[model samples]
Target: MITSPIWLPATLMAGATQAWRTAVQRRVGKTLSINAAGLVRYLYGIPFALILLGGYQLLFPAPFPVLGRLFLPFCLAGGLAQIIATNLLIMAFGHRNFVVGTAYSKTEAVQGAILSFLLMGERLSTLTCAGIGCGVAGVMLLSTGGKRMGPMDFLRALGQPAAITGIASGFFFALTAIGIRRATQEVGGGDPIHAALIVLSVTVLLQTLLQGGYLALREPGEMRKVFTSWRVSGQVGFLSAMGSACWFTGFATAPVALVRIVGQIEVAFTMAFGHFYLGERMARSEAMGLMLVACGVVLALLGAL
Candidate 1:
């Protein structure tokens, strides 16, 4: 069995790298269509993912794990779910400012917790559930931009285009995590990292083919822009590969809910990137919301212990 401690560092790495990659992907979205922007990561990331898998094999040689019958279905489902989640997230970005857009999607932790429980029979401690609640409340608070609104107004706010797309994105992302974790388990191996990398490699390759083919048929012209914007697109791809590797590792080693709870740190990173890197101004409420998210993460960690 994989040691539990490995998930923490892997999740931290995943959060930081994912924040950076999403910021870069948002930049690419400015020049390309939503699907085209979504395609950039997978298209450029496949090579780096392969290299990581190859390098790991060379450093610590092992026979490739035999795939189970369910592996392809899980990988394909995970890959497709991620594609839709990514596009919806990009669409959310269009509906609101970057930071708020991301905050809206931070709901995935709670959603993943629920889905994991219902689908995988994973249970959470009371403290972890509270942490997930805190995180969700913080995200909702951020969505309001610190305005004082009644229940009705808040309900309306949740119905806004950004909220709808963001929540949908979270749901699909939860599905992706579940699918990925299940896929890795199907490998029947003791080396969690090896299984994670193999899943990562296959998932990314499938994503590239699925998204690339859609773009090729529907938006052929954008394909040129995707390649020509190589400088930025390449950075996105590399970070995406690295981030995904870490995320897959976390999934392989820990409960999906726990990994996702810790991964909420991405919201903190996203806010920092928004303020400093993108020149987006943060309101007082946004800062408060971030603190709540941090508290939630702390609670979840303590509960894990």
Candidate 2:
């Protein structure tokens, strides 16, 4: 079956964000005012989301449901959870390491798979279960390092305020996936893609508002960042909205089994970008982990088996 052109765009978007920030750093080298690029990245994400919502509405018109308002609770909870998880991730990422965040986040696939089965009656094959196991093994292998950390050391990392927070946030993200799927069922009937878009729109909008509130308390006067830095911010918003839209659109068009299988290419995309853009050298263990993630994704997407 055809998988959507899902992972490639997402990889590009991820790379673009990194490249944009790196460019900003070079231009402002040693001037040291604000992390102009980073701020712009978050700020412009708002409008990107709005434009995405509008486009979705135009492309797929379904009435705002009057009868299915009950699902709003699920949507809201999921949204709140995503917001919390994301902010926690940002906190850790801001200080500790992006690789840590990325590696740890692989856990979400298992969480998502389990939740999908529980909440949506989407059955998991034995092979898929094995795929999930391999994914976990790969993540663990990727995360481990005798030089930097061992299993206990890794557990200690999780104990970090940010890491624990990430766990909590991941729970929310997982719940959001399931809850959104449920909400999608209510709003989208059986249309998976339609349901995914509706859920994403609702969740992203709510989360964006929450992000605004955080800015109010944290920065208080950061609105200028979005305005003055629209070039950088706009680029950010454009790429983010585009990637998300593609994921949702692809989800709507294909079987989720295939969609998620192709989605695993994101791991490869991350590795490739890191190699070329960030000058990141891959460790032997890292390569093994990446291979595992790739294998697991392929197995998860197995059409014949």
Candidate 3:
């Protein structure tokens, strides 16, 4: 199971694409409507899942009984909490000063690795542990810009509220990965396959309802925009769905800690896509940073794959 690197990288790539797409919406001065975004986040699975779900479903139509029943609620809470974290990121993006906050979030791999060990009984080999450490340093380096600041500088720049919110948001995403994996295990009673599908669907449903409710109350009229212009917003929605689905599948099949750590490949995906499609350029320092990040990923993959 650990040798399967395909879905893990795919999930990372999707994350990059999602961030880039979200940045596009920011450029248009009309971010994705909350409801539309929610739908995208939940139903995004539909585009890819549309064809695959049928086959995946046929593979595992039976229930896991206790497995599916136990982790369902945790999965539900995770889905809803994701919306809250999204809201925070959207707000931070609007503030235009969340660069550091975003970088701070890259440390989520560490958090997930630790939690995976503690809660899921996942153990890492020395190589894997070193790989994870390199991964942390590499991502932190990739996120850091030259001569900007040191440890104290970073600490001083982020106020308590921004720091708290960013850390909380990062933790929520890490937790989401763990929760999905936990749910999948529960669904493993009769058939792990069916359990995975049920967990994904249930999480999606809960996420949609919660996000939809919030949009109805607060951004009541913005729903019209989602349909009015389909290109940008639609892309974001679709990508969101694809990313979540990929992540769900990866978590279902592998150890949570491994999946989360290897998932850092998203940064590279974003950089590559940004260069080709968006004309974003990286300095030599930035490129070197990416190389280190890549090395970390390679290390993680060696142990994992």
Best by lDDT: 1
Tell me the spans in candidate 2 whose CA falls farther than 4 Å from its real position. 1-43, 46-67, 145-166, 188-195, 249-262, 303-305
Ranked by lDDT, the better of candidates 2 and 3 is 3
In candidate 2, which residue pairs get closer than 3 Å at backbone N, Cα or C atoms, i.e. clash?
Answer: 85-169, 193-252
lDDT by residue (1-305, candidate 1, tens digit) is: 23568899999999999999999999999999998999999999999999999999999998878899999999999999999999999999999999888888889999999999999998888898889988888888888766777899989999999999999999999999999999998897689999999999999999999999999999999998999999999999999999999999999999999999999999889988988889888888888989999989999888888
Q: How does each model score on TM-score? A: 0.98, 0.72, 0.80
For model 1, the stretches where C-alpha displacement exceeds 4 angstroms are: 1-3
Local error of candidate 1 at residue 256 (angstroms): 0.7
lDDT (10s digit) by residue, model 2, range 1-305: 22344434443343344333433332332222233333443445556666666676688776654327756777677667655555554544444344444455546667666666666556667786677777767765664521356678877766766556545544555665555545555664444444555666665666556666666567655645546655545665565555555544444444333344445455556555556655656778878887898788767757314
lDDT of 3 by residue, 180-224 (tens): 777777764544445555676677667767766666678767655
- Each model's lDDT comes to 0.92, 0.54, 0.62
Q: Is candidate 1 or candidate 3 better by TM-score?
A: 1
Report the number of the highest-TM-score candidate.
1
The candidate 2 region of ten consecutive residues with least summed lDDT is 25-34
Ranking by lDDT: 1, 3, 2
